[model samples]
Structure formats: C-alpha cells, structure tokens
Target: MTDTALVVGGTRFIGRHTVSDLLANGYDVGMLNRGNHENPFADDGRVTHIEGDRTDERDLRAAKLSTEPDVVIDCVAYHPRDVETAVDVFGDVDGYVYVSSGSSYAEEAIPKREGETPLRPCTPEQATDESGETYGNRKAEGDRVAFAAAEAGVNAMAVRPCVVYGPHDYTERLDYWIDRVLTHDRVVVPGDGQNLWHRAYVEDVASALRTVAERGEPGAAYNVGDRRALTLAETVETVAEAAGTECEAVPASADALAAGGLDPDDFPLYREYPHLLDTCALAALGWESTPVDEAMARTVADHRESDRDGNEWDPGRDAEERVLGVKETL
Candidate 1:
C-alpha cells in the first residue's frame, strides 16, 4: 500500500521541495497552507491542497488532519504552541518530522552536534512575541515540544537545519551574494570573511527530512547540513566562479560596516563566530548533502533563468557602496 503524507506550509522553499520529494517517492501528499502562495505541485493529481491557517485550532480541525496520515512534516512551526496544537490535533501518525533550525542551538560551540550542544530555551513571553528577534529561542522551545509529543506517543522527530540555500529562496539570503557577484565589480565582505558558515542545499534538506520521517528514531533530533564548512570568503568566491564573474572581496571590519551605516544583522552570512552544524547523525541515517560548488552553480543558474531582478538586495547594495567609498578614501 502507498503511504500518505501531509506537509504543513507546502507552498514555498523547503516545504515545496519536500512535497516534490514525497511525490517522487510515490507517496500521496496533502499540503496545508493559507492558499496565498502558488506552488508548482498544486497541479499534480496525487496531491491535495488544504487551505487553512495553522494557528487556528478550528482551521486545523476543519482540515481533518487527525485522520491519521502515514507521515506528517511540519515546515513552519515556530512556537511551542504550534507544536502543541499539531500534536493535539493530529493525535497520532506513523511518523512526524518538525523542521527546526540550527540557530536553536546555544552559542557555546563551533560545530553544533545533535546531542553535544544544549538547546536554548524561550520563555512564554518570548515565544508569543511578534518580533522575530527570538527566532532561535522559540525554535528550540518548539523542538522540545515536538519531542514531548513524541514521548506522549506521537512518533515525532525534529530536523534542525542550518542556513538553507537554493532556487526559489524568497528570503534572498544567498541571492544577495549571487546578485552581487553577477552584477558588481567588487563584493564588500564583513570582518575579513573567515568565519565558517554551514548551509544545505534545499533539495538535499528536503530529502533528509523525508529520510528522517521514514527511518529516523522517534523522539530524536537531527542536525542537517553539509559535512564540510566553508569560510565566507570562500563561499563568495565560489558564487563568483559559478556566475562566471570575478568580483573582488573587499574585507571590511565590523566597526567599518557600523561606521558606514550598515548593521551587522543586515548581512545574511556575517556572523562573528563560526555557525557550523554537525550532520553525522543524519548521514548515519543515509542522507548526503550536495557539494557547495555544485549547489552554487545550480542557484546561479536558477537566478539567471528566472525573473529575479526585482529581488535585489538594496540594503546590502547601499552598505557595499558605503564600505567601498570608505576604502577608496583610505
């Protein structure tokens, strides 16, 4: 018998990729979303779209999610309440995979492993806050809640991924670098560009989520990313190479960026410390990541073929110009 899977928030990014993976794997898929975004898979006959708000208990019940699907993958659960509601509403399933983030790990370690580094906790106030500043804390709390549901016989697991990059990335994090290298003569990188960064290909992350859903231990959390970490400068150079461009990396210190009216948070890959994730647990479960260079090539190609000109990073461009101006003076 074919398995049936439901993907919550299946209209974009990782959710879209996961839906494709499920379909390719021969499983009937159901998508739950607000019906605002357009997904390429909506036309597939084997896929069903359930229109509803995840936060509304009434909407979730209306979707009949408690009918006991073979697998359920939640790609947008940010708060503990979301997880609680999912478990309460879905009741029981063969497998449950919650898409968490590596940011949920504490800042103490360099390469965060699944069980080594402790997870940060969020208070009730922080969990419900509208501001996204508490994103990591809230994700950590949500991970705990998912595992708690697993303990209560929900057969759930959490997949914590680092920076995810590939085609159709609405966030424009990786696109910032791609557009810069393809269009500009020089790319201004913050803080010497030596901090190690970990990122996973969108499709690879989707496959890992499906793998965890099918074979991962219930009540466990897995860190998913490339086995190797690349420096920011190296990452930029790789993108430039993929785009067939040669943009010079203009290294600017944190103080210089601040002086140039650039907030450190504005740069997507600018972290003071290395943000690497250990993916051995997921690898042990038979998931492999796409190489960095190969992934960059695909991303650059996607941008070239798609209508991404409107997706320019204006703040990043302004900051780069300011830093370049200061460098010219020196």
Candidate 2:
C-alpha cells in the first residue's frame, strides 16, 4: 500500500531533498532526469532511476509509463510551456506539485501571501526567454498554468520558496555567509544589519512539497520558509554559533560600501527591502519548519565538509576591510 512518487529533477538541491523526504515517509521514489549529475540514491533498493530529459515530452511520457507514480514532484519546469506539457503528461496523477518562487509576487509587500499577493504577469517573450531577468514572469505563468490544469481536473499545486539553502545547495548563496563566519573574525554586514530576507531550509522546502501534494487544496500555491525569518546580523550570529566560533558582525552603510568600491547587492543575502513570505498556509497542512539554529548547524556542518568557499559571491576581503575601516572612522 506504499505510495509511489516520481521526482523530475531528483539529483540536485531541493529535488534531492524531496526524494529523501518522500522515501523516509514510506513512499517508493523514482527519479526522472538526464543523468548528468551523480545519483546519490543509485544503489538504494527503495529508489528507482528513470533516465530521461524533462524537456522532452517523449521522455516524460516514457517515465510516466515506467513509474506509474501516484504523485509527481516537478523541480525543473522553468517555462510556462514546460508546465503545460507536464500537465498534459501527468494529469492523471494524484497530485502534481510545481516548484515556484517567491519572486513571482508582483508587488512589494511586507509578507507576501499566497492568494492575496499579486503574481507577476508573463509576456509571450518572457515566457520563452531563458534569461534570469524573466524568471519571475515565467514562474508566475507556470503557476497560472498549474491552476488552469487543476480547473481541468488535474490535482496541480505550486510551492513557492524564497532563498532556499542547506546541504548540496549548488547556488552557494548561504555558503558565502558561512564561509565568512568560519574564516573571518569580522564579517561585513550591509546597512543596519537588520535587512530581512526570508529563507527556507532545503529539508523544510522538501517536506512542504510533499505536504502540499498530500493535503493541499487543488490549484493553490503555498509559501515555504522558516517560521522565524532571520535578519542578516542574526543569520551571521547563528552561523557563528553553529560553527562554535565568535565573530563580530560589522555593519556597513551604502556610503561605506561605495567607499570600499562595492554595493549592498555585492554582499550575499543582503536585501534593500524586506522580502518575507507567509507560511501559515503551508503550516496548516501539518507541516513545520526547522528551527533556524538547528538548520544553521546542519548547514555549517555540510559547509565544513565541502570545499565551497563561495568565492564567487565574495566581493573580496580587502574591499570589506576597507568598508570596516570607513565604518570605524564614521
């Protein structure tokens, strides 16, 4: 009587964690992907690998026939057409969850809610464009596609996550901060150190996907994040605490950052405006997020075990040091 689940992109980041969560919850899992990345669950008896390209409809159809999944978690649909194709292919599944983003919200609200917030409108050009500039538009359109599919009797849902971070996070966004806390005694923080950016732990997002698939209302979108959104300063402190270290968070103003020949955006996880999401809807599905402290601890442990210094995200210590010196004189 075990439920069968198929993850479209199961070898990386959020998709990777989703596969693990489903398996732990007594579901037989199958992964359909291009097999470009190494499969962590390759040898596991409970997991199956269905090699295919998600962008190819023939491949998706083949995977559906091979797995006969009760639920489908799509992690790689980037365009509206992708969702349209998926809905056509897996419309018969018990639940079809599309991975959406908080960026899909059109307006700047304190806390973006699922139904109340306005979703960005996607133009025909944006729908087909593969650039990051049109990502929000594309995601919003994908959500609309899912809703339309649900209206047609497909159990399609969407889960929007802002800034997801944890083990195997290829984005390396949070890894930059973890690297700073581990290597530097003084970490340069933007503005008042209270810049808030809601982030979801990878495991929490994974669980949210499953929960939404199981108990979520058809055509509804759910936001996922830690119940307690941490400020930039608090996040640094948490990372330091989790790493068992003492590091000072040095606050830098816009002028100070410019003096150092850098901008606020140069710092990873720093946002000019607060970007928050209301996860109460997801929580109502009997899902809970991991405590920030516990999440940071696991992230730090994974960072310590890897070689990701997040240098791509770092503007350079010399520049940050100049900013610190400017702050000291101020």
Candidate 3:
C-alpha cells in the first residue's frame, strides 16, 4: 500500500515531462534510467531517481522491488522483452501503466475513430527477444508484453501516443520547421505534401499517463492523440505566417537529400496521410493537450534560449526529410 510511482527514461523527452507533472500533482515519484543525460528536475526530495539501464536485469530487479511501488509507468521500452523483465522484477506491484506507440498498429490501416482501434499484431515469443528493434514491429511486440503482463496479475493499462512535441523537445522536429520558417527560408516537403500528421504535446501526454496509472481501465489500450490535425504543407505555411515571415517549400530533391545527409536511396521518407486519434478513449482520464499557439511559443522560446539541450529525440526525427526512404548507394 505504498504510495509511490516509478518512471523509466525519467530524464528525457516525455519521461522528463511526466516526472515534473507527477511532482506538481503531489505524487511521490521515483525515476529510473541509465543517467546518460542531463537531469531535468531540481532536487525536490519528493522525487527519487534511480539510475540504471532498462535492458539490464540487475536494474530491473532493483527498479521493481526497491520501490515497492503502487504504480509503475514505463516510458523507455521499445521492445517487448523489456516489458517481460519489468513484470518479472515487480513481483506483486499493484498498478502498471506502459507507454506504447500508436505505431503499434499498422501505419496503413488504423481507423480514426473514438470507440475502438484495431491493434497491430505481435508474437508472444518476440515479446522477450533481446535483439529485435524496429519502431512499429517492436512496439507491437512491446504491446503484447504490457497487455499480457497486465492480464497476469496487475492493474495494467497501455497508452499509445503519436508525434509528441513541446518545449524541452529533444529532436526539435517541430523546431526544424519553425527554424526554417523563422529564417524566411523554404522548408522542404517530400511530395505533394498533403500528408496529415497527428500531434500531441508532451505535458499533456504526461498528464494522460498519470491519469492512466490512477484511473485507466485495466487490460485496455488508449490512443492519446488530438483532434487537431496538420498536414506538412499546412503546418509549414501556418508556421511561416505565425512567425511573421514569408517562406516556401520545395519538393525534396535527390541532390538536396544527399546534401542534407541522406543517401537519397535507402532512408526514404514514407509518411502516410495521418488520421486524428480517438482521444475519447482518454477523455475519461481527464487528459488534454496544451493550446497550439502557446505550445509553439514556448517551444520557440526554449530553442531560442537553448534550455532544451538534454531533450530526447530519435535518430533523425528532426530532419524534415525522414520517412522519404533515401536509398543507400550500392
């Protein structure tokens, strides 16, 4: 009956923001990570941080049993194996919340609805594989782990978030667009540039997570995304307008791709037209996104002031040209 929560990847991106929100909300918080990045929070003493790798068995044993937590929210899992390790270690914890990705569903066929969603497939065996890693496929595996582990004995819930951004954002994917627009320079778009991208703010995501840990229905997965939708072109134009500047977007070119450090052959950008997530699934948890204008301004200010050096980002999440599939040179 201890009132405590453990968060993995508590110093980076979504994890860091979730920790801050948890502290503000008066929950006893413990953060688990490898301590590879800068610490984002001041020592409030209410929050305890344990540094270690999620992939390490020693760390897992320590994370689950050391706290005897009331709830555990994992923020750093990419493979399902990581999930099994957590379940094994947290023998008899009360509540569990695993942050999964919406990409756990096939990019080509997720219905944009409120009542339910079709989950992508994953095998039980891969759920514990140490070497499997791909965004969508691995997430599918991780989902199985969280879902199955939740079914075994704990009050468990999974939250799937898409395209999270905000102040302290590490990759500055939004920053790339904002920077180019602020410079009054053309931002690059891959093709017809009409693909929609789902958006979620980091703090809002954290709030949803905390709520999920407390009130979310066990053995269920909720899509935590916003109704607000933006196509690549629309966002570029909107940002340019907001920045009080005029810029243009050109179709990405092979030479431009090569110059931007893409092979123009292997890592082709492949964005599907995105759909709005059915956040009604999360409405019961009292989740909400920050206002777009305010979020944008805050992000602009952070990057301008360099207050987000330690934010987490994927390999090329910042590059506007990712998903274009730049084929590797033979």
Each model's lDDT comes to 0.83, 0.95, 0.69
Off by over 4 Å in 1: 64-68, 255-265, 309-313, 316-322, 325-330
Sliding window of 10 residues with minimal summed lDDT for model 1: 307-316
TM-score for each model: 0.92, 0.99, 0.79
Weakest lDDT window of 10 consecutive positions for candidate 3:
261-270
Give the per-residue lDDT of model 3 (tens digit) for 218-308: 7778877655666777777766765667878555655655555643222222265555577787887677777666666666666677643
Error of 1 at 172 (Å): 0.4
Q: Give the residue spans of candidate 3 off by over 4 A.
A: 110-117, 123-133, 241-270, 307-330
How do the residues 1-330 of candidate 1 rate in per-residue lDDT, one tens digit apiece?
889988889888999999999989999888888989886875788888888898988877766553336888989887889988988777677788889999899765867888779999798899997677899999999889888888888888999989888888887777777777888888788888886778888989999999999999988999988766777888889888898889888888777787678855667777877888888899999898888788889989998886664344556577678888988887
Model 3 quality (TM-score): 0.79
* Predicted candidate 2 versus true structure: per-residue lDDT over 1-330, tens digit per residue: 999999999998999999999999999999999999999999999999999899999999999998899999999999999999999999999999999999999999989999999999999999999999999999999999999999999999999999999999988989999999999899899899999999999999999999999999989999999999999999999999999999999988888899889999998888989999999999989999999899999999999998887889989899998898888888
Query: Native-vs-model 1 lDDT?
Result: 0.83
What does candidate 3 score in Cα RMSD to the true structure?
Answer: 5.9
The residue pairs that clash in candidate 1, if any, are: none
